[model samples]
Target: MTQVDKASRKPCIALMGEFSAGKSTLANLLIGSDPLPVQVIATQLPPVWISHGDAPAFRVDLDGNQFAIDLDNLAEAPLDETAYIKIFCDEELLLQCDLLDMPGISDPNMSSEVWQRMISKADGVLWCSHATQAWRQSEAAVWASLPPDLYQRSLLLLTRIDKITSERDRQKLIRRVRAETEGLFLQCLPISLLQATAEQDDYDVWLKSGAEDFAKHLVDLLHSLSEDGAVGPEGQSLPEAAKPLRISGLVAPDSAPAPPPAPAPQTAAPQIMPRRVRLSPSPQDRACARDGAPGRPS
Candidate 1:
């Protein structure tokens, strides 16, 4: 794609994991709204492509046809024929990027083809593995098949981290996943998605839940993709070489330096330099010049 085309299209981040890995919960937390139904019943639904807007919901069939669908009745969506469901919301996060909430890779009720079809559409992925059973062989097998380009932009999230109980165990799990999946993901983080979502009003709780680091990295990723002049390996832009923004306490600290000012706007279109004019002296003037006098030729 051309640079403009790549820049114009919002980066698509796919959320993939095993069953009940808290993918939906992370989606809800990042979006700051639950556009998709988060009930157990809705877990079995097809991939949901969420973008920014106030448009009504629709489902895309395998043949690339769109049909209007009701959000309340999404659980009834036909799994076999549907390619993916499209959801739009006026959330701030959606304004920066799109989120694809994919089904579990090992869902017995749903065919692997269901999510496999949608993987190509992702610019990045957040692969959620349950903290208790982090980075299983099955997860690794599937991740191995993905293109290397996606790996640079992708992340491995150990969800339900609160269940791990001990800091030592948590750190050990993080180290183990990082070692095993080295170069496969940008970073491996343990997160309590449930706590992050529940503690929306409490910054300290949110940070403790591991949402703060996740959010910072996420924003950096999106900003990199948006500002980079060229498309990155997976069509997402990699982070620029400059220093990253310093975030503090769930927001920018007052002491932090402000972002550089925008360039001054040009008030007028640039004027083309006039082509150099060669003025041939008029015949009379030429004669007078030859005569070395200021009057007409006598």
Candidate 2:
């Protein structure tokens, strides 16, 4: 396929969830490096459209105008008037799919319009709900409005599963979310974004952190999108010119096939650990916490 065709065909997977749902953390983990500014600054900006390339950053205004931007000074980009900031990188995972790091759905400081406007660009969604507060009413209400076709393509992630601590609580939380979002998502997985991103050098830690299983399913989903004609937000088919490409470092060497149908609720629950819950700003959060930028509401 030609370069332009390949770019158009690359499946765009949006990372969405409430504020502090670890969406940014997951983005950094998948990309194998943090390309955007720290979360403090990032959460305030428009949807960051990340794709596979080496081109410098630029902002796409609401009028479809493209203006050169300096990543170091991303704060200067007017969030109110911009459509989305396009960030290009050469990450391997990005070669197979474009990851749109969307702002929190319920961000009080930012309007819903910011993310709503970009929904049309997504082929699928990786919705990250906090394990402690999985599937809130607001989240459910918003998700209910999404295209029905996307329900089968979307994956609901109960992030920060490690925070639940007890196995019983973890199982209960998973079961509850599963029941509440039945048929609304392809599958639900409990994961610790912090653990997954921190255990890069240790294969065992990486697998145990739930990244392995997540990666396997994600790759399979991308492959499926490439083969099938998944429709975009506008009810138009997304581009499908390129063949499926293997992501090098994200999936484990011996990753199992997409997790088998989840076992019956009474069976031994999956041994996925809950994620860390930080009341204070994390190092990353603190990095952008300077200048009294509005903090992400819990």
Candidate 3:
């Protein structure tokens, strides 16, 4: 393919994981708004797909005919071999990329075969695994099977990390999880999706949630993956030394953070270190998440 042909094809990043692992939270952060519905909906429904769009939403059936989804009624939609429902949003961040928010791979009711269909189109994934139970044997097995190219583009997110509370415990858990899935993901990031959501506007919230580190890595990775060059197994340019483009975004997940960048022109400052996540529709999970809850703002 010509260099121009390759540059035109935008990368698609899928937010994938078990139910309630905070997949939607990461999506919301990128979209810079609460476009994707975050409810307590569990397994019995269809995929809540997202892409770049002008309107906040429209539901597309298995055949791709666009129809309005109440967004609220996703759980009631038919799921029997009807393909997946597409949810469209107009988030600006999508201008440079596509985000696929997928269904739970571990749901007993859903077949692995179903999620498999979506993998080929995905250039990368942000795999959300719960912090305490980070990488299960099942997750590892599946992640191991993905094309290595995807791994260079993917991020393994350890969600709900606030549970451990202790710095030592958190590091230990992160270390063990990475050791178990070594070479499977480009990088492993631990962040409290819940805290990030509740404290969306706070820089400290983003850093403390560990999202700052993840965001920096994401920007660097996406910039590298978007280029058109012979990719090496190391995820860099082959033969020629790869000088990955430095991508600037509204968010920066850094350690010794600086002032948040101003929106748009003035500074193109990183986004408000947004840490927002909406809860999915769940009976028991909701209770566990909120039992020790903080005031959840929009």
Candidate 4:
């Protein structure tokens, strides 16, 4: 790949949502590990973590010194002065993509400046809201302030989808939230992060939580971003070509291969087709080929 192509290949997706929007849960699901600390109680601190080899989670202070973390307790760790903590995991799927599991956007205890600085480093965002009370005006208003570049790459996820018992309620929230966000998001998917975790063994859970659709959507979005050449709001090129889902580091090494048998395999091989090309010499090559004009300045 050319340098320009290589520059466009790095895929980074940031998860931004209100407190306890299952942001950590979603990350766990995608990574196939609950190793990430998740709880209803607000242990809200910026864990600027990413996945790779099963490296240790180190406390990275402002000076960039690395200290081992307890994983059970990050609260005691200082965040205001610390640069960020990096958690390395065996999940190879993250190699191609870097995930920024950011803290809540409008937390009273934590200043916006904390998350805002991280936002500047994101390539795209996954904004999760609780399905029970989704797409709140506060969420919309905050999302509105995001620049158009962010808007184009952002996706809204209505988490805790199983909370809505009735199908009527599901459709209602879907339509309602869709209307509110409209064109702001590339896609908005309703997911039951809880159910998804519970039925991790069951194939139905993936579809039920809407992760199946969400995964497909994410693949398309990541590919589009790669092709569009807009890595961030700054319009820097993204790194080499990749289908986000198939990325090496984002998923676990021993993760199960997908169940077989589709009318057409979803992981279809790229089709090659013959095409026409002009073999004629250009003005720049006139000295060699004479531009194919009879005796023209050979």
Q: What is the C-alpha RMSD of each candidate to the true structure, in Å?
A: 21.6, 13.4, 10.5, 16.3
Error of 3 at 238 (Å): 21
Tell me the tens digit of each residue's lDDT in model 4 across 1-298. 2436435545567888887777776676555555555442457576566756677677777676878887667666786876666776664346546677878776788877667665656678989998998988888887877667778788899988898899998998899899988889988899776554455345555447775566666666676666756353234554453223342112111124445544655688755443211111121111111111111000
Question: Candidate 1: which stretches are off by over 4 Å?
Answer: 1-8, 38-43, 200-204, 228-298
Model 1, poorest ten-residue lDDT window?
Answer: 289-298
lDDT of 2 at 73: 68
The candidate that wins on lDDT is 2
Candidate 2 lDDT tens digits, 3-52: 34434466789999998887876776666566776644543778888887
**Clashes by residue pair, model 1:** none
Candidate 3 residue lDDT tens string, 170-283? 999999988987777889888876665455446567558775566567756665656543243333443322222221222422234457655577656645443322222221
Q: Distance (Å) between predicted and true CA of 83, model 1? A: 0.9
Q: How far in Å is the alpha carbon of 177 misplaced in model 3?
A: 1.5
Candidate 3 similarity to native, TM-score: 0.70
Error of 3 at 201 (Å): 6.4
Quantify all predictions' global Cα lDDT against the true fold: 0.69, 0.71, 0.62, 0.63
Q: Which stretches of candidate 3 lie over 4 Å from their true place?
A: 1-8, 38-40, 55-68, 200-205, 229-298
**Model 2 ranges off by over 4 Å:** 1-8, 39-43, 200-204, 229-298
- Displacement of the residue 209 alpha carbon in candidate 4, Å: 2.1
